[model samples]
Target: MDRVDLLPPPADAVAHRADAYAAAPLLNSLLREVAERLPEPGDRPVYRLPGGRLLRVRGERRPAEPEVRTAGGWRRVNHTELVKLVAEELTRHTGLSNHDLPAEMLDSRDAVAALLAARDRATAPGDPYLRSEQCLVTGHPHHPAPKARGGGPVAAWLPYAPEAHARFPLVLLGLREDAVVEEGDTAALDALGDAPPGYRLLPAHPWQLDLVSCAAAFEDGRLIRLGTTPFDVWPTAAIRTVYAPANDLFLKFSLDVRITNDIRRLWRHDLLKLRRTDEAVASAFAASPGGAVWLSDRGYRTAGFAFEELAVLVRDGLRDHVRPGATPLLAAALVEGFEGSPLDTLEDPAAWWEAYLRAVVPPVLAAFADHGVVLEAHLQNTLVAVTDDGMPVQALFRDAEGVKLLADVPRAQGWERLVYCLVVNHLWEIAAALAERRPGFEPWPAARRELARHDLPEIRALLTSPTLPGKTNLLLRWTGADGAAARYLPLPNPLAGA
Candidate 1:
């Protein structure tokens, strides 16, 4: 055993991560929705909430080390105190009582502390792409408790944490051939490894296996172990979806943990409609110009007995869609940052921003207008491939699960959802990151130009709308609503008149 483990933990580690973890979403919600900025006092940004409650934070990006006005004035608020402060202010500001979100806030803080500790001891992946995928410590710019791992004990989920740079082999199983329920091209699964004559190969995420109860399946001869994979797979930002570099394939699993607003499970309803949804987006990309590709959810395989629990989704890997010389990087990592992120040492912010807009915006607009396909082109679902000099070469999108066809939703509703996902959630966040790094640089003009190029009627309104829809994640989690049933509040539109 390590001597450091024997020594009963340090105070600084816990407090530092907790403050950082707790501050971001609270600051995001407070500033974006409730608080009004009261000119910068020195270097720090200060805000005045309802009833003149003044709050200030140390920095931008992942705002840390919060301080608030008190009887003594300008006293530092710890994580616990911060949670109380958020609850109090929100209650008064929104005319609502949310007892649950406060707990999730604390849970998020505690979870961050756990991740930080685990990362300290863990070894990072050798592959830079994998490193980028795992680099998101502060995920979901506007989400409260983005790192909250279902409020479970540390050991229960720590090993599966992408933030900790964890990479482990999949738990391979042999489900009887009769029990295999599948859709689309699952041939890649067969190529993963061999299965016995009577059985079919089904690779499972180890963490998911641990969470699920499967003794009956194992005992009834429906499922049997066929040993683990020879090589390890890197878990992406979406913890349940892992990349196997050796096979050049992606496998998504059903995890029960609540990541952001929803329990990360591959739902049965989604599984049933996967082919239709993926085909629509795939056809859209096929027709669209600008080298934008769709990383299709090619197929899914699951056991009939434990359908959802055993379900595994197979998606197109980076090898297939990524341009020959260019490297594909997670769009979220471009915002969150990784070692080799093009966003980190951007030589020319304007050129970079334009290239980014060219890559991400066109296909999305084309898909919506031409094919009536609404893609959830949020940061996590989009991948931008860059050239040798870090200029974006291509944009590849994934996750058919979130696609909403215009035939299903009203045209107005689909457009609203598209604008929120593509512009507010994806583009605006990246723009803010670039702006922070290169002061006096604005990213919205180029963004506006890109949208105007689409010639869609929605683009005209999008440019003029005083407010953009921002997802109300904190409120959603507090109200205990379904994740797909997204509710939005208006955010001051930076795109307007830029």
Candidate 2:
């Protein structure tokens, strides 16, 4: 690997990452729902925006090398130019100007450049699964500014970045028993390290501690440092969550950074509702027809004062849920196109896709239809385990915080969220990735069949729906809504025809 120095990356490296970072979401929003296609299609399909502005991109699934029409033919749009173009397009189309989003759009591109530079220099993890977990350079393919890392310095977040294939020891802190506030089963935290008689062991994300100011508390002896973990923990696709393979533990920490929709902190409200939501979904999977597994968020531990900042959730790891021989891979990594992704190397794409859908789809749909549990079964939260032949045999889901009970949302709203997450976000991306690699194999027919087998009324409506609810990430950010607050626009549903 060509190592980029810690100081500064070369200009070309900067441009490449920036272009990739900016082009993806801009292309995604345009191609998926916005752009008007030119009559003839070629190697590079040209799209027309409102007011007759022309846009062209390199590829379909993960669009790259964006270009726009200028007075002199087509001109390549850099990250900055693309952001301006997006802003202009959105303004013209929506009749609104979001000044903040344009800056964030630029920041996102710059963040990608930093990640790329770091990856170039750093030695990526050798383990295929870890590698897959770390591979998310594109990130939230539909979002305008997916890689924007809090608009912080490269040094601030790079060490903990999964995209950079970073693995480091957790900063172990000893919090006074009286000061530590926790609920549910957080016994797993105690096993990480020992503490004095008056203190409890609390492992923290080193990067998080740096970002949050707690020097006063540390100086006053409320919190004590007990040194870093003896061994490194592999950062999963979710940058805040790390997997300690030695202990078979998944540790999720509160990150104030805006990842996708929200500032990905383990919020108190979510924590309060966690057990209920997790239990309902877990029960559904346990009783469901398929042998799908729910990697439960057993419990959480945090400092009394720094509730969200210092919070860390303990989760069950792959050992308990995954089959003995089958290897677990992040579904997001599969869609994002990782090194060992089954989608990439599939010899029989159709059969593999069928197995994938069979393993993943039933449990998600069943959880909603039978158990009144709405799981955020997006790519990041879903894990599909493959056999020796890379055939998906089991689907394991995680993240209780994202779960919503039917009691919380009405039936229609819950169904809409389910369809969006499952069909649009998760399944659509997988099918697209599968098609991208294996050209002839169409994944939607199998997906349609999978939905057809299920007797849910929503499933029937889903089959015939002209357009699926596509989340408007760019507009969401532009309008400055809460990240989890989803706003949808209709996209031509592949399931309608296939």
Candidate 3:
């Protein structure tokens, strides 16, 4: 957990590091989603594939340096070989062959290599919050291809990548008054730049502009290209979302590229339902205990002709919602590790973790129990604000597009989604990271105490359940399932025994 100042690794070393970074999540998915665990005596635990091939890895949290048993004895597999092995095993396991996912796995590894090279040359943001937002090099630890930038050329996406510490100005555009379709409060868009008469000011992500075709609209006088914004915005872990400090605003845009499970676009259906979901979550936060806040997605603006591709959502910034004198950091980045992470220098791990639970656990549970609002309270969507002493004080949650209400879905289904996001994805990763830094620290007991205090009907079953729902991102993508439609496999529940 000690901070170190070391020179960047050489090109070959960088490639190796990238392979390790990219392989961890893919291995986690393969082990969790398909491979069956086999009893082994050595330090490395072995898994039996559907084809009866035995595989073993070096670590548990971020499994690495994979090796498979063959006629020549144990043979090491690099990221590329690992991808091939996974593909063949998945085919045997699912009775379906997928050619695209293997390519994406390779692309994800190559993207990591490019990010590592760019990060070595670029300067990280001075602000700790921005640092947390941009520090996710190994993103979505349960995903097979978290960093695949739609298999685009490195040159096309590198300049906009958050992992590269890249920041740039927004490309301003003018949607002709008659062609503009807007909902909610979008006054912030006009403040970014000015548009000529008969046009409404709209802001577009520059990378998205490259991916989407807006030339026809521009030529037909439906859309006009205004100059770029005067200020630069920093891309957050959600690559399409950017933070404008001067305006104190967060802008979520529709990018044509598929980053994780689906194409990262602001779909028309989700946008239409955004207000209801955001309002329900915002109300839930208002009624909950403690200092938890909901960073509201106020509104959106887009061209009617290209609704999904051109939509830009305006989200509440940190200034208003975050507790005063506290710096907010992305929850996922804490697990990933950053230069200014409190996990590295905390004096008391137990106290720090207790404070984290108090700040994060209550609102999420209360929202689901009392208000029937299921928030996507995963690591990426939640931010923990810490005091100067590195003690967590408050939690802020965002992304209305991911929110679901009980009216829309059955209660059991909503609870499952909440448990997956809140416990499995958010708390479990933080516990693992904290335990990795401080060996002997048991995080589950305190987590159990926190949940036991809640009076929800589901709490009893949650604490006693032998397994928790773990999303199958690998199988979901391989089978071409809709990203929003989540499928879960059972994972051993630590809370059950705590």
Best by the TM-score measure:
3
Candidate 3 lDDT over 358-464, as tens digits, reads: 99999998998889899999999999999999999999999999999999999999999999999999999999999989999999999999999999989999999
- The models' CA-based lDDT, in order, is 0.85, 0.84, 0.93
True-structure RMSD, every candidate: 3.9, 3.3, 1.9
lDDT by residue (325-345, candidate 2, tens digit) is 999888888876766767656
* Leading candidate by lDDT: 3
lDDT of 1 by residue, 1-498 (tens): 001121224767555655665577667866666678888648988989876888888776656667987898788887788788878887786778887678778888887777778778887776667877888877787887788888778888888889988888998899999999999999998887789999999999988998899899899989999999999888899999999998889899999888888888999999999999999999999987789999999999999988998899999988878889998888998887777878777799999999999999999999999999999999999989999889998999999999999989999999989989998899988998899889999889999888888789888888999999988876676567888788888888998969
For model 3, the superposed segments whose C-alpha errors exceed 4 Å read 1-9
lDDT rank order:
3, 1, 2
Which 10-residue window in model 2 sums to the lowest lDDT?
1-10
Stretches off by above 4 angstroms in model 1 are: 1-14, 38-43, 50-52, 93-99
